[model samples]
Each structure stands twice: as structure tokens, then as C-alpha cells.
Target chain A: MMLISAIILIIMIVILPLETGRFLERFDKGHQNDTGMVFLSGFLLQLVLFFPVALGTMFFIRQDNFVWCTRIYLILSCIPAIAGAVCRIRKLKEKKPAAGPERKAEVYKNTGEEKNGKFRDAEKTILWAAFFIILAYQLYKAVTTAFIDGDNTFYVTQSLIAQQQGVMFTNLPYTGGPTSLDMRHALAVLPLWFAYLAKVSGIHATVLCKTVMPLFLIPFTYLVFFEIAKRLYPEEKNNIPFFLCLVAVFEMFGSVSIYTSERFFLTRTWQGKAMLGSVVIPVIILALLMIAADIRDKSNANIKTAWYLIVSAGIFSGICTSLGVAFSALLTLGGCLVIAIRDRKPKLFAMSMLACIPQAVYMVLYVILK
Target chain B: MISRLWAYLELNIETVKNYAGTGFLLLIYAAAFAYLLISEKDKAKRVIFVWIPGLTLLFFFLPPVRWMYMKYIDGSATYYRVLWLIPVAMTIAHGFTRICEGFKLIGLPVAVALIALCGGDVYHSVAGPLVIASKAQNEYHIPQEVIETADIIMANEQGHRVKAVMPLDFTSYIRQYDTDLYLAYGRELIMRPDAYDELYSMLCEDPIDVEKMREAAIPRQVSYYVFPKTSGFVKDPESCGLEKAGETKDHVIYRDPEELEYMSGISYYYFTD
Candidate 1:
């Protein structure tokens, strides 16, 4: 049963999300080869879509909101995943297109460009080994060590309640007493997502959140960093492994204080606030980079998709943590304003504002509810 | 308003201090920014690593922006998240990688040494590693005592869902293990300074006032009480209306026979308030 549950969870989180993300690859023609973006796009798609549907279900059908929401989301998600699979099949069948300049550069660069440099294949191998070792150490600690936070009394309990009782926010997680909908936490449905995973996989919610989650969240976070490294060193692929090694080391020793993103990333990987700090924020930065690149190259075809990704990221932030709603918007606006002013494209600012509309709506909802 | 702004600024500074710790990583981050600003030729990389981070640092430090944020967005407690936009790890990694582009042998050792020397070892911090993380005893990652206590309660339970008065330690994990069990008071009532409940105070008090607690709990239909074996009690609970149900390694479980009888008389659904 444990093995079955593990398989089900991997399929739900990894395979299905990647398949769904394959459909989003259509928008960004430049990044067809980028699996990192595909995973992110699909993950965000699920989260962004889940929030409103879950909200609407809770608003309209108070009882069995968990069931209805889970079923609806699962069915809704399959559409994109299936479409992505078909797209993958079609792409596989089509005649091989000649490698573009960028693709050719990616292929040529990782190997021969650094022949004369001090960093050889062996050094690169060492860097790669170091990176994997760091990752393994973190994962080992995450699995074996039990880091108990006071907040888990609420968050983990909430997921368990939703999974076992099939109710959303109706039961107080601390005790089994009834509660009115927690307007603040209800909007951030990360716990509900956990509940859905537990319910589907038949894994205990506590075990899943504490053990299985970090396994995915840690590596998934690194996947985001890997994509960032790729972007930072598009030409110097050798540096990519070293960059990742640095990142892993930073995260390892990042327990500067309890408040740092690094501490939260390692200690509270399953929590919504942690995801907001680490994943959602980095994603916004990645999207901004992609958007800026698209604009500079006059690549409007995929640029809109990148901007739309910002929009989706806004909603995704809200799904992860309520504070994320504002943080993502502020970050987007800040980055976009700089881009707009630098490039003399005022429309970029407007597009950023448009991207923040969902977050604006969520904030307004919070204010009204508060 | 000026005073409020000053207070917010102090809060922001404190947040930065807490985030920066020994300031070594932040210094590395700053050095990375300088490197990127000077040498990074790619327009996108410049925007991402240098300009955006610079603007974000400015935005984070500005008191007015923080005031507006605390007032309108969320609260001051989360204002530190504004710095999350800076991409500290990415910048440091990129900068060090860039600076060491040519000298692999020296650069790798230097980078690793700098990180080790400057950074706090997470596993050996001020509180010690055990406080942060210890080997989980079970698949649930719950303490063995908690699982044992729950097991005892579950074994003793009749058809009705168990409504127990658990100590503060057990209150959190018990419900996570079994939703059918309810607590008399929760973590919120204790953790939140402003909230209060008499039953919680009386039941959880050291040298627990048994008669007063029983008088208070009987009306609420609490059927069990699980406390640490070392807990001080004014009187033995079994001498009162309760019976010694079972024991775990660390906890003594007691059941109110009268309350159980009372609860069984009425058909109670687990979902009921």
C-alpha cells in the first residue's frame, strides 16, 4: 500500500503535471526543449485553476466541497494533460527540424567550448558529484529527521481533517470543533491540495506532509534553480553544475535565522509560506527574465505567454500563501517598471498591472472578508 | 504617522538583521551584484541579477513602501518577504561562478571554504540539531508517546468518538492521527495570548485541580484525560469519577466512566459539535 501510494503521488505530482506542462510549451516556442519551464507551467496551471474552482465550489456547495473540488480539478486537469500527451505524440512523429542557432549553441557549448580552460570534464564531473551529494544529504535529513514546528498543529491537522472528514475549513484543525470558514487561510488552499493527494493516494496525511512532501519540494525547488542557472549561463554550461552546487550549499547553511527563506525551505518545505518564499518568488523572477529576453529580441509570439505566466504565477502565489498574493504583485510591478522605463515601453508596465489583476482581486476579497 | 513610520523602519531593520545573520551571505550577495553590474553583458542577465535586485533592495529599505505594505497588503511580520525578491542564492552562485570562471582548482576550494567559514551550520546551530530535527520514530513522524497515547484511547473507546482533555503536547498530534477524537482545548487557545478558556486552564494546570476540572468537564461531556506520568495532580483522578484506562510509556490515560455512560446514552455522530 505504501509503494502504491508513493507511485500514485509521483504520478499526480510529477508525471501528470509534466504532461500538462507540455501543452503550455506551445506558447513559448523558444523554450520547447526546456523541461523545467514545462514542469513549472503545468504546476502553476493546476494551482491557478484549483484556487477559483475550489473557492466557487466552497461558496456554492458548502458540504462535500472537498469531494466536488477534487473531482472537478482532477477532471479539468486531465484535459490539458491529455492534450499535452497528444502534442508530444505528434511532435515525436513529425520530421526532425534543423537545430536552430540557440539549440545548436546549447548542444555545442556543454562540451567543446571549454577545452583549453582549466575546468575539464573531470572537474565538471566533480562539481556534478558535489551537487548530487549535497542534494542527497538534504533529502536524507528531510526523510529521516522530524522537524516539529508549532504551526504544523494547524496546517497538518487541517490537511488530515479535510482528507478524513471530506470537509474544507468547516472543522477547526486544533480541536474537532466546528468553525466558520477561515477567510484568510481558506484562500490559500495548499493544505487542501495536500488533503487531495492523501485522499487519492491513501497515504496518511501526516506521513505524506512530513516525509513524502520534502522529497518532492526540495528537488522541485532545485529544478527551478537549475532552470535559473541555465538562463544565467546559457553559454557556460560547465558553470551550471557549480552554480547548482553553490545553491545547494547556500540552502544547506542558509539557516542564518529562523526567518530566512533558506531555513523555511529546509525546515518547513511542506508549508504554504515556505513555498511562497522559495518557489513562487523565484518563478516570478524567472518569468520576468523570460519576458525581458522576449521583449529585447522582439519575440512577441512567446512574450505574451510569459506575461500570462506572470498572471498565472500571481494566482499561484495566492494558492500557496496569502501574503504571496501581494509579494508576487509587488515583485512583478517592480521588475516590470524597471523594464518599462529602461526599454521605453510603457505598455510593459500596463501588462504587468494586468498580470496582477487576479492578485488584486484576491487582496480585495481578503479586505472585504476581513 | 511619523512615529509609526519610525517604528516600521525599526521593524524592517530588525527583519533585515535577522535575515542576514552574520551578514557573510549578504556580503557575498552584494559582491555578486557588483560583479554582475561590472561584467555581465547580457541585457536580460543585467536586468535580472543587477537592476531588479538593486531596485528591490531599495524598495525593501524604503520606510514608506513598507508602511504602505503593512497598512494595505499584509502585516509587518511578513515584510521581510520583500527581500525575498532579491534572489540571494542565485546572485551569489552566479557571481562566484563568474568570478571563478578561469581558476577551477583554486576557485572551488575558496568558494566551499568561504561558505563553510561564514555560514551557520544548520545541523549544529545554537539550539543544537535535536531541537531542529530528530529521527522520526514512526511513519507519521509523530512522537512515539503520542501514537501510544492515541492507541490507548482508541482501544478504550466505545462506539462514540472520543472527546478527551489532552495536555498541550498531545493536543496537536492526537487529532492529526485520529479526527474522530476531539480536544477540550486546542493549540490556538493557548498559543494566542488574547484567547482564554477556563476548562483548558484548569485541566492543563500543574497539580491539576481534579474536582474543579471534573465539574467543568462533565457538562462538556469530555470522556477521557491523557496526561504525562510526571504531571502533578491535586488528587488522583481515579479516586474521583474517572477510572484508570491504560498507560503509554510517557502518559497515563484515564477515562470518565460516568461521561462515557452519559455519551453512550445518546447517539453522537463524530461530526457533531
Candidate 2:
């Protein structure tokens, strides 16, 4: 069964997301986004599309037959991602994307590109050096501390249970039976998604939850940070290294900050709460930057793509954790209010607020749900 | 109130003094944040670089917010304040960017100095403690002896999980290896007494309250009583109507004379204090 599952996962993981990302890139201006960003955005979109169905399947079927329920949940979840990739391909024939690896992530208006100089190569070398140095330094802090914290135990137990029992929200870890656990059920299942993949891939749930997320997501997090920095200084190529330098050198509050996103990224990256703070918060910041750039550049078509990105992020927030969507709404509402009142771009504000609806709905569920 | 405030101020001063290098880096972030906020033009960029860090620093100063989190939330705001590190990182980034841009041709030298300065802080504030903790975690592992004993008992159990009462110290040692079985007294926050009430003693009070645990086992499920060979607990399994089922080199597993009731379901309440 494990071998069967592993064979299926190997094909589904990369190919589907790559095709989906390439197709999704079509809606953007000349497809002028970064390759990594497009891939992650497509992956995030797939996660958002498939989560509800996977969760619904897990709930009813899990009690009767756990193994098949897990297999069924995974199989059902892959459909939308695969289908969306195909549909997007059929829709977007041959207008090539000009983003990501193809070109530098766009600068906002015409502030002009960086001047060629002897210092430029030195600056980039220093930038790449700083990136690795910071990555290693933070990873040291993250990996060493281990999951001695409270919520770490909570999510570890949940993920482990999913791997062992092939069920969700049913078995208690200490004394096994149906869980009377109540909060928002939406917040409860984020760990299960990681567990599902671990189940099929034959990786231990603990290692996936602990090592893999920080190892992978933290680097992607830097990419997200770079995109935001690029949007901030679109033409000032010198600023790219400056942005990275900031990413590396800032250790603010030090160990005094017991619960910083840095701490979460290093130690608790696997948990839903950590994902919300580290991953989703940064994505929200990136979306806000893109929205600001679109309004400034007055690109209506790009504006459409940007709004779609925000909604996709919002949907991801719902599946990732309840707090993610709530934070998304708070960030969008705050950003929209700023743009609406200050920039007098009420249309942009209105559209951004509309984009925040999925997040708002998720927040409502968090508030009203039993 | 003034005296209390003075005491609080002194304590914080001491904390800052313990690692003055971090304090200095924090000061750099603050100064840069303030200067950049005043000088920078782009409000959008400033939000990421300036206001977020500034607001978080503002959160640090607000004693009421600090107190509420300290009192009601977790015992400290330090963990929740981890979010502030983002702003702090950006603020440091902001400082580096400003210095490099200011120096122009000499920016590389300036960048080197900044990295060195921050590296010093990372050493004192983070790296020193991280090395110690990492070493401790690597060196202190559970013995293979306990793990093998657990494996033998599990293999003999005919695919059914046996409920066992043992010392709480070895509970994690057993469960760490496998989860198919139950520990009547384990490291869970929410644990209820099994039918024989063997768990109430070791967990509820410090010394083993053997008097409370001596009641005979009730029949409805499988039950086992396990103890290490080095145990100081009263070793008579017959008191609880359990017969010695098996023994390993370091441990023994005792089975109930009759069937025992199964305990299942989430332990609804947990005691923290």
C-alpha cells in the first residue's frame, strides 16, 4: 500500500503544480512574474481549491474506513489542481509570460534601472553571501531549539495521529476515542494536509512537520520577501541586495522575543499558527505591494491579476488556519482604508475589499461556528 | 507605585545589561526607524520598513498590553512578541540599506562593518545559548535498553494494545517508541484514573499513594501492571488482583486475573497549575 501510494504521489506533486503555475501566469502582464512566485502561487491556489473537498471527504469517511478515507481524500484533492491546470492551458493558448526567470520582477513606474558600475557585481556577491549567511544563522536558531513549546506538542500529536490512524479530529492522543474538541474545525485541519502527504510519501509525520517545512518554506519565504522588496523599488536594482541585507541582519529583540515570527519559522513552522504568521502574513504584505503597484502604474489588466492573487491568498488563509483569513481581512481592510482615504482611489479600495471577501467569510465562520 | 516602577525599571535595565550587544543593535534599529520615517517618501515602502517595526517597539513600551498578555495569555508576552522580530529584521535591513546608500563607493566596507557588528550581537544573544542547548539535546538520548524491552512486550501482545500502569518517568520512554499501547499514567495534561485507580497516586501527589491504588481490578478490558526492576513501589501485583504475565531483564508486565474495562475517549479537562 505504501509503495502504491508513493508511486502516485511522485507524479502528482511537481508536474501538476508546474503546469498550473505556468497557465496561471498568463493572466499577469506579459506573464512578468518570477518563476518561483508563480509556482508557489499556483501551489497555494491548488491547496485552496482542493482543501474543502478533501476535508469534507475526511470527516464522513474517516470513522468507517480510515485508510481508504485517507487515500480517497488525497485522490479527490488532486482533481481540481489537475483540472484547473488543464482548463487554464486550454484557455491561455500561446501568449508567453515575461515574468520570473524570463525577466527581473518588474519595477513600478519609470524610475530607471540601476546604472552599470564596478560596485554592482560586488554588491550582488555580498547580497548572495548575506542571504546564505542569514539562512544558516536562522536555521541554526530554528533547528536547535526543537519543539519544546506548547502548541508544537499539540500539532505534533495531531499530525502523528493522522499518519497512524488515517483519521482526523476523532482520536484523542492520550486516551483514544472520539474527540470532543471544539473551537473552529477550520483551524484544526491544516496539519492534516501535511500529514496526508507524509502518509503517502512514507515520511514520518514528525520529520515533515519539523524539518521539511522550515527547510523548504523558509527559503520560499525569502523569495516572497524579495518580491515585496522588488515591488517597493522596481527600478532601483541596487535595492535588491539592500532588501536581502535587511532580511539577514535584523535580529531585533533577540531571544527576548519569545514568540516572534522568526522563532515560529525556525521552531514551529509545521503548525497552522506558525504557517499563518510566517507564511500567510508575508503573502498578505506581498499582495498589498502588488495592489499598490497596480494602482500607481494604472494597469487595469494587472489589477485583475493582483485581485485574483489576493483572493487566492484569502482562500489559502481559510484552509491554512482561521487566523490566516482574519489577518488577511485585517491587513486588506487596513491597506484599503489607507489607499481609499489617502490616495482617493476608491475603486481600487472597493476591488481590494471585494477580494478580501473569502477571508471575511472565513472570519465569520470562526466567529459564529460551534 | 513609584517605588514599584523603579524596581521594574531596574529589572529591565538588568536584562538589557545582561546582553548589551543586543541592546545596541536594537538601538540602531530604533534610530534608523525614526530617521527613515522622517526622511523617506514612499508611504507603502515605509509601512514595511518603518511603521511595522516602530509599532512593535511601541507595543514593547505599552505596559498595559504587556501586563494583559503576561497575566492572562501565556505567562509572558515574549513569545507573542516574536511577530515583532519581522519589523526588527526589516529595521536592521533599513539601517544597512541607509548606511550602504550613504557611503556610496565605500559601502562595501560599511556593509562589512555592519555585518560584523550584527554578527557580534548574534553571537552573544543567540549563538552562545543555541550551542549549549544543541549539545545537551544531542548528548541526552533515551537508552536503547528501555526501547528494546518495550519492543519485546509489544511483539508478544497479539496485535492488541495493553493498558499498563507503570512509573510516570518511563511512560514517555515507552510511548516514544510506539503509540499502539496505553500508559495509565503518562505525560498528558488531561489524564483520568483507570478503573483500578492506579494513576491517581503517582500524578495527583508526589509520593506514590499506594493505599489509593490497591483496589482490585474490574473486568471488561485488558490490563497490565509494569514496573522496572529498580522500582521502589510496593511490588505485590496480587494486591490489585493482577498475575505476573511476563518479565524482561529490567522490567516486568503483570496481567489482570480477569477481564478489565476499556478506557477510551478524550480526557475533557486538564489541570495546569
DockQ of each: 0.51, 0.20
Compose the digit string of candidate 2's lDDT tens values, residues A1-370. 6576546554455555655666667656444445666666666765775566555655445353335546665666566556656755675576553233544543335565535566766766766676678778766655454434434434665666667766664555553434543355534467777767677677666655655455556666677777666676566667776667566554322443343455455545677666766667667767666666566666554455556667787777677665456556655666666656656878867777788877666666566654
- Candidate 2's DockQ is 0.20
lDDT of 1: 0.80
**What do the candidate models score in CA lDDT, each in turn?**
0.80, 0.56
Q: What is the C-alpha lDDT profile of model 1 across B22-109, one tens digit per residue? A: 8887787777788889999878888998899898887788789887887777764777778877888888888889889877556877
* Candidate 2: segments with Cα more than 4 A from true spot: A1-15, A29-33, A58-69, A80-114, A117-119, A136-145, A181-186, A249-254, B1-26, B50-86, B102-153, B165-178, B185-200, B203-231, B236-273
Clashing pairs in 1: none
